[model samples]
Target: MKNTTLYKKFFVAINGSNSEQRPLSIALSGGVDSVVLLHLCYTLREQMPGWVIEAIYIDHGLSVDSDSWRAFCQRLCESLSIDFKTASVEVKAKARHSLEAQARDARYAALDSLAMANSMIVLGQHGDDQLETFLLRLKRGSGLDGLASMRAQRILDSGRVCIRPLLNASREDIEAFARMFAIEHIEDHSNKDDRFDRNFLRNQVIPLFKSRFNGFLQSVLRSIELLQQQQSLIEELTLQDLQTCCSEQGQLDLQRLGALSQLRQANVVRSWLASFNEKMPSKVQLEQLLHQALTSKQDAQINIVMGKGCVKKHRGFLYFVIAQDPPQPCVDVALAPITLNDGRALIVEHGVGVRAPNNNERISVQFGLLSSKIRPRNKPGRNAVKHWLKEAGVPSWQRAHVPLIFYDEQLVQIVGYYFEHSMYVPQQGVRWEVVDGE
Candidate 1:
């Protein structure tokens, strides 16, 4: 196979003619697809003098042959005079996720950590991979976002752009290129394991389709392109709706979200979740979420856990809370300022009408004092800590995490809400205030 078209497409994808300089890192897996991609990119480095070419091999440690694959990648990179790096990652397959998915996640995480800012990380996924992803998502009843499959270019979490320059090329094209160039590559034995859904599709389903229908891959690609366009439109509309539905502190206004159509509501919710880089909910989970949002009573508390986080509805707003360990108990407050487990600091400052702790008084910071009462600086009467938090517009999810300054058994002040004015006279004195650290 001729390399002219592939080289041109790769060059354009990396913006080879651009005057700005940025490094390009190829994700090399010692596979034919990646080897051909690396070779093509290496051949173009002379034309794009501003670009730095490098290769990264991520060893998931799932197989005994991983070391040999890493060595192959290193030797290939050395032969091409390109910088080589290897990251060893542990693949922890949870009960809910497959080993393949876990390995992919670990590999991408390693690659993201190895990538630099403003660099382009090249992947070797081809047209067949895209088709498999689409079919898998379809079988799982995915929405437009999943059905659209992978994109040619996407911004990663490390501020690096991931580009699949070979997305339009087929696996046969890659294999032919590898043979024509005499590129040395290794085959992962796991690829032949049909127990994995993707492998099963590649070995059994896809071949059956190819045998029965001419140009089936091309037809699938055309459908994917159309679905991608439709998905893009939905995303644009969701962004516009999200502006109206977003509330303070990155929460979503449930009332505003409810005003939209059901499909629009799901789109906005998905868009909101993506803003925080949260994993997308499954079809059933999403349906349940929409049902809860649309039908649940206004006064009822709603909390639904999904992935590593949860969707919670409180006070007419929706919040995504990442599952985290309980906040550690606050430490004893001495004369110096102390920081809390939630990144808030307890500071002692000298001010008028401030109450200074006595020598015998036990000074400390505490959280979740629901029954505690405090007389705010300007308020008329003592109010419950929970009520004050609600009046101050603090969400229910964050109320328990609010740091409270206590002198012995009495709640002296609530951080960011009330400081007891009557605790001390108007003189040069010391008071405690909680400062936001994040």
Candidate 2:
């Protein structure tokens, strides 16, 4: 509870983090927790030799005082001689998502863009925050991973490392440290509103719980630690199961996955989705996915949509298909990169590809020409583009997006799939490739 003890605890946590070599970007919200963290890190700057401590404030533009909050954080950083930066983001609400969720997503996205590459992001979440998150997840019927709650240090899917030095520090200790240093911070008016679940818990539920049980927080913390250990073991086993059932193309082999128990099957599905950085489906949705995947007819087409993409089953393999806009037909062709409308790039390069276009020929790129025929090099004869794509195991929904390169009116190349047999050259020649857009 003493200021010195609090400082020592934070120092030990940060010093042992192994992020001393990297710059630290504090997610400063101009609140008590963050202000205290900033003060501690800045005061101990002499001890952390390699750390370049800075503060980044993300303005969600939701509150009228958002700019004032940013200015406050900037001034605080200036007083401490710490670098300060701000990013303003528009929080757009989406279906089946709360405003808090949207704002949180926007805030993190702004942080990711504003922070330096490979910089460690420092968040000022305390023990009370962790307990609130645990309760919220529990209310939503979260599993082991959710119950494990926040990690002191976690590497995000974007490969950015985030650390919480105050995770184990109690709110009381943080407030005491602030009072001891006479630290200044702004109180967000939204914190007083009980309509939000977290705010309600922090303002009402937690206080009552603490009053009734002095050691409740400590017991919950121990439970979370134990849950984290169990979740880590589960993740290890899930990876092994994934390796056995997932294909090189990132598709899960239904037969292999079905061999596992129903619970194991669900675990594998969840892990597979996570590997792709896709959002996890609800319990009902996940159950439906498994049922359709295992019981559907062999020739049945399964297309279930979730989180920026749809999942499809093809030949017993479950594939995650990112939603792409319809490809627009292009009339020009050159030995350069052509940006496609469907978030893909058509690159034409000289290699063991198709022969170069003649001076009299007009080259162009087209899409949705599945009815057209093209003779692939080394193949027996010309076949419909649709049939070629089928033989190549291209999903039906994606066939329309495949770029078709033509010399004048003749089909010469299928961009990525194959080159026209007549125009193909085994030696040095121009070839085409399709890649994800930047």
Q: List the residue pairs that clash in candidate 2.
A: none
lDDT of 2 by residue, 226-262 (tens): 9999999989998999999998878999999999999
Predicted candidate 1 versus true structure: per-residue lDDT over 1-438, tens digit per residue? 224666666667666423365677889999998999898878777764556878999988888998988998989898889999899998786897778788887878888888766667889998999999999999998877789999988776766677888777778777877777787899989899999889999999999998999999989999999999998887888899999999768888988988998888988988898888888887678899989976888766789887668888877888899855435666565878886676767777776545787888887777777788888788889889998888887878788887777888878777667777577556777666768898
Candidate lDDT scores, in order, read: 0.81, 0.87
Off by over 4 Å in 1: 1-3, 16-21, 116-118, 193-195, 211-214, 323-337, 347-362, 375-384, 390-393, 424-431
Measured with C-alpha atoms, the lDDT of residue 118 in candidate 2 is 70
Q: After TM-score superposition, what is the CA distance of residue 332 in candidate 2 from its true location, in Å? A: 7.1
Question: Which ranges in model 2 have alpha carbons more than 4 Å from their true place?
Answer: 1-3, 92-95, 325-365, 374-383, 403-408, 412-438
- Using TM-score as the measure, which candidate wins? 1
